[model samples]
Target: MAVWSLWSLLLWEALLPPEVTHAQVQGQVGGHALLVANRPSSFQVREAIWRSLWPAEELLATFFRGSLETLYHSRFLGRAQLHSNLSLELRPLEPGDSGNFSVLLVDTAGRAWTQTLQLKVYDAVPRPVVQVFIAVSGDAQAPKTCQVFLSCWAPNISDITYSWRREGTVDLGIEPSGLFTDGPALRVSLGPEDKSVAYSCIVSNPVSWDLATVTPWESCHREAGPGRASYKDVLLVVLPVLLLLILAGVSAWHLGPCSGKKKKDVCADEVAPEAENPLV
Candidate 1:
């Protein structure tokens, strides 16, 4: 009877306070789906256990080393005699890190408690690369054609399937290179006006997926037009030349030989003298 009573007392004493049991550490990347819990308290915690769904090969010791210190900070606090909650950190997290984990807590009296965690690792997709070149028409106002080449890169991934999506449109078919190449380039034709449209690339491995968006631009279409003069532009230029010609004509008319008095009367004087002699 005494043994039963003592065991009951032990169980009650081992039961944590509601607040302590409710204590947790939560970290998420991307969204709530990628959350992890069970950060240690900043008080005297006797033990901490880390379990990860990530592949043991992918997880390095360096990742867990700092987190261990972070979890044990409560034990080192000189002023406040408070125990801190434990935390889990993995170094060099990979797509495989997506899954579940648990941390077991052992008390000074050797009793143990465990917490369950659901961890989701999101694979980071490499940004899609696109190169665009434009061909213009003779008419400056006319639309131009844009030639685009797209490629995707994720060196960390060995085998992957790729897909291209236009933001406002549907999916385009994927071409397989069968192996990695420097120019995994895809050619797409567009108009200069459509250069503002965004293109997206979706990269997927067996474990994860990543996406990247690139705004299309044209090299030839970047400028409004080449820095040159047109017929209308030349007409604006000729107006000044025409104004100068008119000004010169008016100045000559105002101050010229035509405006001076005429030289006359010499020949008429000789004839008048002959007529006067006959009369005498």
Candidate 2:
């Protein structure tokens, strides 16, 4: 059933006139948007009619040429303003106001033309949060180079845009990856020669924008010790194993005679002397 509804919507959009869906204007809920249009060039227009096209067609406003007053639909009272150029401005736009709208112009010569557009109203973008992660790039020229991934996002929003600005880290890799242009993420490579760096991310919608900044720590194997084991550490491990091996060899020699059939008798004879005189 849901599939059928989506199919029907696609078919409806496909059947719409090209002008009706050619462009889109975004509005912030509870904010205003100015939908602009130009005066017809051929001759003086005698009248203009603005109408909503979706959810059933309905008239929104009417303006007679050279008239001081414009008539608006009852629903649009105190919400819409009509301009001399036939442009429309809607204030305190609500989510319910999102839909297709068109304007009809009739010239004094009986010629007519129409321009249509779609509006998508959304909540204003909230302040974005910036996140950073680091990894090794292993580039040959700068071994130990760190690749930093920076992400910027706004909660509870979709279909918005992201941009980034960077500061600091002038010594090493300063140029960023392609995502820096418009993607929500960016990558930067830095080497040991590089210093600390900071990044800023800007998140925006058609109506509003917010920004966040963050500084990334160098990528590394830290906290515990050095990246490579030192010779002293290697000796500390090897010496203990060598000593244990020597002790095991000596124990095996003393126990070797006891492994065979006569071992029990020989072992007791060898141990009797030690048993009589204790080490202490």
Candidate 3:
């Protein structure tokens, strides 16, 4: 589960924090790091011993240049190596491996030196999420003048930071407060000229960062809720129902005249039988 790779300059720029000395090295869990003591080669015929100093003090390795043989400690067995260049390499770093370490070096002339290094291991940062909720000045009535709240977060991580920023230029309307941020949340006040603008939320730690982008104008400027229909949609539905009602009224009026004609004809056909009897 361990393999060594070349440490590129760009990788160090991204991982190393500010004000850290060359002796300080940061790595991700399940990754590799090479710790160098930066000892000058002029100090010849040397012996070196490396030890873990913080959290727990323990011996890592001991090397003698004359014998060209090294002894390893159980803590770093099968996972650490002492190189000829007087550097220590650790692969597949563990979470419990963070702390301070030092190396004691003795030259042929009996002069001794000690170098200390700080090691830190971190978990990779996960992708962040952005969510938004909008509130109008008069409930659902004053949509043009409303507040938009956006929240950004990453899950289950520690020692992280949140930052909010807008991508491009924006023109604010009504309230004209524009945008303001507090920690992971941002508040925006929409006005008349409030066009669509992109916003980014960044979540980061010392070693990694992730960002999410959203445009609040898309949701805030929408005139209709998901459950409500637009004006054009309502007209499209009502026009068909009105046409059916007008057709029904015309058919009922035509049937009324036919019924009256039929009644008059029946009376004429009945004749005056009583009058005929009197004439006889």
TM-score ranking, high to low: 3, 2, 1
Per-residue lDDT tens digits for candidate 2, residues 202-244, read: 8887788888977654333331124655456688999999999
Off by over 4 Å in 3: 1-22, 40-42, 66-71, 139-143, 169-182, 191-195, 222-280
> Candidate 3's residue-wise lDDT over 188-280, tens digit each?
776556656778888887878888989877676564445667567799999999999999999878766435677657655565565467654
Candidate 3 has an lDDT of 0.70
Candidate 1 vs 2: which has more lDDT: 2
Ranking by lDDT: 3, 2, 1
Off by over 4 Å in 1: 1-124, 133-143, 170-183, 223-280
Estimate candidate 1's RMSD in Å: 15.3
Clashes of 2: 0
Q: Comparing candidate 1 with candidate 2, which one achieves the higher TM-score?
A: 2
What is the lDDT for 117 in model 2? Answer: 78
The CA lDDT of each predicted structure is 0.47, 0.68, 0.70
Error of 3 at 269 (Å): 24
